[model samples]
Target: MALTTALNAASVYGAMSRLANRAQSVQTQAGGSGESGGLDFGNMLRDQVKSVVAQGNASEAKQAGLMAGKADLVDVVTAVSETEVALDTMVSVRDRVISAYEEIMRMPI
Candidate 1:
């Protein structure tokens, strides 16, 4: 039937669209700039860690303001907590990368 054929075509199109979206997501996660090649993983990680540390510092300043009755305690706490989690994750990633580098260096050329 024509209805069945149309439905199949629609289903195929939908699947293709989903696949394209997934590919784009993967590319973005891999640090590819739109139309540009992939970014260096170490550089990307370093930049992210630096940004997270800056956020953490800002959160600390906000917390200090809360203590001085300038900002809300709840907002300050949430910011600080999120920053703490980011910093912890950054530190863990750095440790893993360093360990991998050391292991690689230990291998005979």
Candidate 2:
């Protein structure tokens, strides 16, 4: 009976430890940083923009190949179109941000 009680205690302790570790993992993910404990929005946005640009460049290359008849016409058109749209969206966002910055600067403090 003593041995069974000790075993149960050990099991309960083990389970608690596991739960604590899992809670820490979830907190880290939700907070987005292990040390600072918050999301880095600027870093995330930069990373996303970099990926989009890279994808657009790849699509442009594919489209160029299609133009040379080395690739299918439909594929080329689709890739080029998608790249154009992505680039346009990026440019518009940049313009809007710049405008907002300018407007903020013009405001009297």
Q: For this target, which candidate reaches the highest lDDT against the unseen true structure? A: 1
Clashes of each: 0, 0
**Residue runs of model 1 more than 4 Å from their true location after superposition:** 1-36
In angstroms, the error of model 1 at 46 is: 3.1
Q: What TM-score goes with each of the models?
A: 0.58, 0.55
The CA lDDT of each predicted structure is 0.65, 0.61
Model 2: per-residue Cα lDDT at residue 3:
50
Model 2 CA deviation exceeding 4 Å by range: 1-38, 67-69
User: What is the C-alpha lDDT profile of model 2 across 4-60, one tens digit per residue?
Assistant: 743553454344345445655675777754445676554454554655556555665
User: Number of the top candidate by TM-score?
Assistant: 1
Q: Write the per-residue lDDT of candidate 1 for residues 1-109, one digit (tens) a residue.
A: 8457435534543443454456556768977654446665644654564567467567767866977999998897798678668756766876898999999999999
lDDT over C-alpha atoms for residue 31 of model 2: 75
Q: Would you list the clashing residue pairs of candidate 1?
A: none
